[model samples]
Target: MLRGQAKGMATLFGQMLPAESSQGAEKAVQWAEVAGRLQSIWTEFQVEQLSKASGEKSHYTDPVKWIATFEAVMRQLPLSNPQVQQGLWDEVIAVLTAVLGQYGMGPRAFEEAKGDPHMPLRDRRFADPEWRSKPIFAVLHQLYLLLSTQVMKHAEAIEDLEPGRKAQLIFAAKTIVDALSPANFPLTNPVALAKANETGGESLIRGFEHMLDDLRKGQLTHTNPAAFKLGENIAVTPGKVVHETDLFQIIQYTPTTDKVLATPLVIFPPWINRFYILDLNAKKSFVRWAVEQGLTVFMVSWKSADASMADLLWDDYIQAQIDAIDHVRERLKVPAVHTIGYCVAGTTLAATLAVLARKGEADKVASATFFTAQVDFEGAGDLKVFVDDQQIETIGQLSPEGYVDGRYLAATFNILRGNDLIWNYVEKNYLKGEEYPAFDLLHWNGDVTNLPARWHRDYLRDLYRDNRLVVADSLSACGVPIDLHRITTPAYVQAGREDHIAPPSSVWKFTHYLSGPQTFLLAGSGHIAGVVNPPSSGKYQYWTNDESPDTLEEFVAGAKEHPGSWWPHWVEWIRALGSDEVSARGKRRPGGRGDKVIEDAPGRYVMTR
Candidate 1:
């Protein structure tokens, strides 16, 4: 079956290239017509499917079947029609001409112009001794990039299909190009070639051994465990588990200051990973910094979900947050507590606040801060492509033992940045025979956690598919309807400028829902890096607009750029929101008012796997 599919794809491509004699303008016109015909074919297929199911439920809700149907119809598209083929042929000739011109220039021209910013071929691999000195290799690299660019252009030209389907097509085209990059193979990649020549091919032998070792372990080896140990070098924040439940443990870090704020800060880190991401190490730990700044910090460390916890629902998670918040309030003996939620936890926090508001008890949350979390899903970015009626159904089927495996969730996220998180590791560990580095952030990234199947399914259905979170009283949790607009707690919203998982634009939508004084911040870097940014690094800058513009674009346009991390700015914002300075209070011991110590700082839940 696979062989036949490969042959069919090859035949389709073969028919997509026109003869050399084809005219350019005429071919362009024909290509446009062919694109129109493909759209018509897609429309016809949809009509026929609808007609066949006139009196019955549609099978379009079954994503696996819907995808198969889409592929079948797409295969019938006249992509290889005469005019389209001619246009493709013209693109080919143009690339060929460019490649020949570069080849004729012969190595010397390239070497002299190597560092020029305007150079067409900017890839460093093309400048290596194995390729830069060889014209053929140089031309091959250029041709690959040129062809990939043209292919992507064609993919983008495809329209009239559903948004998800269109994105899938474009993604598939890009994946093909990425897979065929010259750096993946030993013969084409200069670095790999140099390694082969250096150790007499011993690197390849070692790489093969590493691959077998990973296979035996049934997982990709992302880090060398020997390089770093948990609770010693990493996750070493000094604290005690002041409270525990079946779902989560609250860790109260030992205070580093003599005077701490009266209002204790409670953090709800996303349960998708270990809570240690906020407390990775001394230098990078946000928890430590917050403590040093004279604040009592309590972190909710969630237990890793397994088969035993498969029946856990969304209400259960929300209740866990309430339980943690109540515990912090009771221990601190404060009327209200400041709250911080990261990613999915932020979403849950918003919902929890709404639930509290419905009961007229929302004043318990003095203020709220959301990091890389989205309350509105309309512009949720590329991750939305995977959240549809059919896709949700397929995911539901994959949840064995009532839980979505953490490895599967991790793999999905890796695909969002395939080059950095997936291919880079493949090249370094499998092709280059390099050992994984002892990076604290990378270690936290590799520590995956599972999600309850019911919770995962409901989240996608209610938030992404239905988009009920934005509508007042449309979403209900724990028998209480959630109206985001009803919660008037002061909010601090931060989004990463380059975040793909949760785009800055989506995060900006929080401005529309909140009724209190709100501050929006845009930080540089991706999701994790942007949120974990510390001031001492002096690496990335952040943007802020005092006006709080009505739209994301307006805020971005009027925002002032600030050097250094956003941490200090955040501290000031919290202080302004009634976290006043008080006499220093050292870290509260584990046992107080029926609150018993479960374990040490890192706790059992974080060390579960």
Candidate 2:
């Protein structure tokens, strides 16, 4: 299956080449050179390994060790080139001169700390008493930064390299430097050393115990599970489960206002996570805020896929959403319903809308709001690096149970932001023997859900790898062709400025694909924080442009900055779409089509382990 997919990808790449003869030939030659160089590099790496194994002091024969050694050397190969070495030496000399000039300039020269919020490693080793007051360590840190900068510059200067290859090279260099940082070692990391001294080595003992507990549980220690209960402290919004299916449950949130909008709102959250992300707490819940705004809201609580659900496919999810939408329309007795989709759900919703458009029933949706969703995966960011042929093939072979394990997905995401999600936890929980914080967000992050093998495979292929969703007739769902251009519903799209998962530029491209009047919001935080932002927080700001530009760069340039949350902006947009004020329903009604109430809000599906 993976080999076929790979061949298709090659075909797509070939088709993407410029139609012009000269340009096409030049690109072909560049691709050929890259392929040849990669092969040669691998060959040299194998030869070096064999040579090392035959030495007087033989290298470790472990396959894992060999692979790690090869990867490390490959990352440094570019730096070893004569041209790159020259550039790096020049940068080193310049940094040294700067450091020397600062020597006699008083305490101010040495006062600047190595740690910057942008640089994670600066805080580790440099924070130790031995290094903190020493000017030499500071100079060494600056020189390291200079070397990294120069290496990146060199990588970027490689002419005609594919964007993917360039990105990989830059990331590889970064990973190597991060791994080799002095801060990771116990002797060099002052914080770790001080903790050991203060605790008389108790911290290490406790850390060892924590590691054992985590291993036994088959997961990382991310949050204090005892600190939260689903229906109490976390998913506490008042609601009732009006319906249930094999795939999901529909929760009808009780209105907080005296009157509600005539057009009800329905939400489809990404199944990769629990639904409570939007309803994390009373203070942070978007669901609660919407309810207070007099919008009668209903949310789909997706079942955590297990062995029984391993056969579920993408079509199954889309159909379930369609069924939920129909149920909402009937239950609320509204001809049309407003819809919101978050993350993967947003992608699925877009596809469903296209299916609706094909069936001449697009009017069923009053309006569509997409939160950090991507239809065009062209600039999908670093996550793309892990979705290539070899990786996908490996996953396919391993997931014989017909589901991708949630733990693997969690680990991959954690690695993407290792400084915050992985290493910070390592330094605190393992080194410092600190307990994991009882933060609600981290708790939700740890509560992962499996993706059915078929669904996961198809999604990565059709969307991320094939780029089929944006291309008309290239993909289909629910037995109908999918195309974003066909959907005419007015859209409210939000993207995070600092979101590595779905870059703002990629999210902004949604405006270009949708034919309707689209409003693009650029939030100031990342994927989760940006969307969960409430006005009361007064934390992150957002940007908006009435005149949606053709390009993301232009939109950003001309956009007006707004203080606080984008919730009010979304509320106004939904209001403008013409939801009438009406008396709020006091009690839960039976779900549409005689579907019986299964349980209360934060229902069984959501509570699935």
Candidate 3:
């Protein structure tokens, strides 16, 4: 059955290159040679591996269920209108006809035939010159484009479906298409085949070894993990832990400037990852930058939780932040401290702010800044696909121990950018047998952290699914009925324009809920790079407007585009909040350590895993 199906597919593919003309005949012969080599190498590896197996049969040739699964799911959704089905069928036939028309053409004619209106966007996966220069590869690329785009296009065309279902369908279809790309398979990947030939099949052997290693490790290798160390290289900023709790440790960074702002800054990074993401290196570190800018910086390093920590709830997380806030205030001898939170930490901080406001202690935080944080999940984008009730329950069941496994969370985020984070590594490490360059960002990304089961479930349900953070009294934190409107503290909201995890529209909704002086800045790039972007690199730009417009589109329309990182702009805004400069702390200790110092920066809590 498998061989017959494979032969049928090969025949259909062969017809897409004419056999009559001499030029077509030449290209067809080249394709056959390539196919023969690929088949030999694949069969050799499979047989060799199968011989050593435990006698359990493997289903390598099973037909792909991506599109079939999509069809099944869509049939159950509200996309069954006859017009929608007809529209999808008409598009599929039109694309198929256009694609098949290039069969009998010569090289130049085939190249020009790409001018058909249905040609997909320039996909970087097939960017190699050989994809166009070689006829078979070009045909494979074009046909793959037709199938993938049609799947996604039909998914988007079901306008009658609910917004949530539509978004889920589009994301699911895209993921399926991305996984089924010809570029992922050695037999279909032109680059992998050429590399195999060049190396006399050694690349395939090395790739097999690499695949085995990744299987043992239980994750794809995106970077050389050994290339970086926490204290020695990546998170090498100078600081000392001032306070510790079961939930978190507070690291007080020694200031770089002689004088520091009177109001110290406390940063609460997402517990899903280490705080070192903000202190990646001296150059890229936002914490280091803030310290150098004459500000006292304290970072909250969240402990990597296990099943023992599973019973912790959203209120517990909020209380932990509250504890950190109070500790920073008392240690610095200040009435209030400026605060910043990234991602989930920012969401919790917003709740803490509401809780503080309800308790009539709003002034404890001098100013608040959010990095790619969303309080409103109403168009939260692809991340929402993982948040429906059934999946949440499944996640709980998977985590019998009390905390959601960090690897599982890592996998969830990886699925969001499958083409980049998942398949790219699969191609490089497992197909090409090449190692990715050492990158601090990828290193930090791979260093995942567990979430307390109760906290994780409540977060997804309350903030993501129910979206109670923005609604008055709909959500509560620290036993206080939470109303984001009561957060009258001065606020600085920054969101990445291209962020997928936290969409700008949802982040912009932070402005709507906060009854405070507000500044909404839109940074370039996705979530991490945008937030960690520093001034010296002089990379992507940011947008700003004098007024926080009601709609994200309106804000974009009236905003001024400024070049380079938004770091300097943020510093200026926070400085204008009017805090005096004071002599830097820790004059007595060797490393400028404060009296309550526990350990060095990038604390032991971060090194847990």
Candidate 4:
């Protein structure tokens, strides 16, 4: 079946090839016509193929089914309400008027209309010169923009719609609008047609091959996967595993200086992903930078969850953190360790600190640092859209292995920024047959870890849905009630200004609960880039305010913006917190002079897919 599909696609490409003797403007028009014909044939072929595979009409392959689903969803909206119906009608009329007016004006008007108010001037998809220069493509683009705008306005205008339903409706409407963009189709996309012409139809042939490969992989290729390797080009920090457990391994890094801080720093990365994000490369590595600052750094590399680990709960993860802290304290003979957590680990770290305070073990962790982690879920960004009761109940059925696959989490995160993360790659990789650049961070993003089903369930219910972690004695971890208010450990909370997973507003809510002195910093980018901004890169800036204001706005009002990475400021803050020096541990022996070493840095556990 696959061979036949490949041959059929090749035969179609053969029909698209231009005679070598033909050249100039005439050839371009001919190629555009060829692309239009291919688009029609491709649609029919796709529908037939999907129908055969499913043994029934496929939802995606059938345009009628897609329209039906969209209509059904829209029908549930309050369109019957007189006010809503009137508002929608007005919006549709306005859209039609704009589109028809533009169509009547024709190509010469579009050239001048580039500066028009309704033009999607900043939108990247229409950046190709042909979209503006060509009449048909320009009109199609304007029509799509006008109609999609009306659909969204209608979705948002639904009177008295519940917030969750409203968000879902807006998202669904957006998904449909984005999917149906004229630029996504070869016939309408001048760039794709030009490439097909330039390659003599070879680009389209390769595009089909790319699509088949992606289908086999069951995910879109965002970056060249062959470009990166763990512990080589990425995650290449020098360290060794000091201890190993069924759940995680502790990696103690090789120090760079003659002396180190007396208090060792242990980092607990989110189990939902590989710990290597902090150690992407020598230049970007937060781990290497800390080691260069003469700090004894240890990282918790979590094991990828499988069916055997599915029974693990919130308490289990919390206990594992405590156990790691204790092991570091006992092995290094230190009274305390500085701790840092990113994303989910940071939330768990807040819980761990509360549990420690409740158990009189708060002194075990001297200082806590959070990177884009939210303890309080109120106003927690778009991720909240997926946390309603219906979705939470279906978490278990997501995987038969009794664990949520890492890919599922990755895809959900991608959906939040679908145009950039999902559709952009689809157009580039499959439609254009182009390989994306070698981005170390994106490569690391693709390497994700599964979540234990029980842990995920408890986390969503107790923290996200119930908002229990903030209230004293309301949430319990490891059989002990944990409260953020009891945590007296000095904290450095860093949030990304553009973070969707953990909104900075929600992150700043730490001020409302923590019974400790806090310094809040806001970085200039989204989740990963914001947190991973290293001093060496001199990239995005970060804002800081010593005054932990009650509101995020007040905090921003009083905040001073710095022009580079926040790492040096954080390192300085770490030093200010009593930086007594100790002789640096021998590098040959990772943990210490006599401590047992499990394996090299990054460890076997983090290397797991």
In each prediction, how many residue pairs overlap at the backbone (N, C-alpha, C within less than 3 A)? 2, 1, 0, 0
Candidate 4 lDDT over residue span 214-326, tens digit each: 65454566777899988778888887888989999999888888899999899999998888889888898899999989898999999999899978988888899999999
lDDT of 3 by residue, 423-475 (tens): 88877776776866799889889898888888788889988899878889987
Give the clashing pairs for model 4. Answer: none
Clashing residue pairs in candidate 2 are 128-190
Give the residue spans of candidate 1 off by over 4 A. 1-79, 100-110, 113-121, 124-129, 133-136, 187-190, 579-595
Where does candidate 2 stray beyond 4 Å?
Answer: 1-76, 82-130, 133-154, 586-596
State in Å the error of residue 376, model 3: 1.4
The TM-score, computed over Cα atoms with residue i paired to residue i, of candidate 4 is 0.87
* C-alpha lDDT of residue 441 in model 1: 75
Please give the CA lDDT of all the candidate structures: 0.75, 0.75, 0.79, 0.79
Residues 329-350 of candidate 2 have per-residue lDDT tens digits of: 8776778899999989998999
Question: Which of 1 and 4 is ahead in lDDT?
Answer: 4
- Kindly indicate the candidate among 2 and 4 with the higher TM-score: 4
**Order of candidate numbers by TM-score, starting with the best:** 4, 3, 1, 2
